[model samples]
Target chain A: MVIINGEEQNAAGLTVAEVLARGDYNAARVAVEKNGLLVPKREFGGAVVSDGDVLEIVAFFGGG
Target chain B: MIPAKEEMLAALKERIGGDLLEKFQSSAAAVCGLGGLGSNIAVSLARAGVGRLFLYDFDDVDVTNLNRQQYKASQIGMSKADALRENLLEIAPYTEIISQKVKITEDNALPLLKDADVICEAFDKAESKAMLCNLVLEKLPEKYLVAASGLSGLGTGNSILTRRVSERFYICGDGESDVDTCGTLFAPRVCLCASHQALAALRILAGLYDV
Candidate 1:
């Protein structure tokens, strides 16, 4: 099980892309971080998730 | 008798306390995007006697920006950076205002933001904000970043707030509100958000980083 956005989930061996898709997050709008290191948007497809890995997804909204 | 410039500065120091005032006078901030949020943040920081400000904007002062942004009708044709510089100088003449008329991107953000103690993210687009925040957090980890993400139409003033994302990142506004849902942009709410950003920056500069 891996932690995504602080929620526990069974995501071992899943790529970042699969994890994002499972969570229904819009790929184009969010910046993802894995264990405090940024996973550049382009490499999401190849970065795999491991047990207990922490992921933080931040979505930006326009205003200021 | 007319007071000397030093006398005036001394008066401010007496009001804010010598140590705090000195911190404000020594700290530098880089404000990206001289729109409503950026311009207002710059204005407040300048008025508070912040020592140096680096202003960036690629757009000219459009007539449409007057509704919320800090610009005058007479200054419509001028570049946003130049017009904002004029505004800041009028408030705090001693402040070092470095205005640049160019777009900031991932490729150039580091060099542009490297010197400032704080980076103010006031871009109007989500993509632009994300790009700057990501690049800054990844590359320039030492600098504190204050970003505003909401404050659309005339919603309740209390809904807008300042939130700390992490040790180095802080965001102002309701975090979830936007122009799409709030309808249109207005001055009061937008300025409120700008104040939050400015206050957060000042706190960071003064070493009040508990938030």
Candidate 2:
């Protein structure tokens, strides 16, 4: 299981894109972190989730 | 010429206590985007007599921004940093206002914010906000970052809140309302988020970080 945003998920070996798709997060508006390291937007598709990994996602929105 | 420096300090000390006021007046805060949120945050910190303000913005005051931003009608074409500096100096002449008309990027983010004790991320775009937040979170680990996200639309004022996302990062906004879907960004709601960012920055500057 992968821990995403502090919640456990059965996402071992799944790509970040798949995880984001499952969570319904707006990909364009978020910054993803894999285990304490920031995952740039370009790497989301190729990066895969592994068991016991922690992920933190922050969403950004328009306006000052 | 409103009052003497000693008189103003005495009044501030009377209101906020001398110790905390000193802390507030000794630290500096960097406002990355001199738009609605940045302008409001700068004003609050200036009134509290934050020793220095690094106001950075590359845009000029547009006619449309007059609705929510702090720019005056006469300063329509003036750069945001310069215009805000002029306005803030009028309010708190002693508070050093350093305005920079330049855009922030990952390469220059660290050096640009090196001297700030607290940084306010008030960009108008999601990409810019994410870039600055990610850069500061990774590169400038010693400084505190007060960022705003999902602060668009006419949402309930109470919904706009300040959340301590990490030891050094604080996010202030509803975390849901985006301008893309909301179709509008009103002054009242924008200012609400700005107030949250301002308070968080001030609290950090005062050595009170528990938000």
Instruction: Give the TM-score of each candidate.
Output: 0.89, 0.91
**All candidates' lDDT scores?**
0.86, 0.88
Every model's TM-score on chain B:
0.95, 0.97
Q: Encode model 2's per-residue lDDT on B10-58: one tens digit a residue.
A: 9988998988888988898999999989998899899987988999999
How far off is residue B87 in model 2, in Å? 0.8
Q: How many backbone clashes does candidate 1 have?
A: 0
Candidate 1 local lDDT, A2-64, one digit each (tens): 887678999999998998898786676567778877788888899999998888777677776
Runs with alpha carbons beyond 4 Å of true place in candidate 2: A15-17, A26-28, A34-54
Off by over 4 Å in 1: A1-13, B1-4, B180-183
Report the error of model 1 at residue B201, Å.
0.9
Per-residue alpha-carbon lDDT of candidate 2 for residues A1-64, written as tens digits (9 for 90 to 100): 8988789989999999889998898787777778766677778899999999988878898888
- Cα deviation of A10, candidate 1, in Å: 5.3
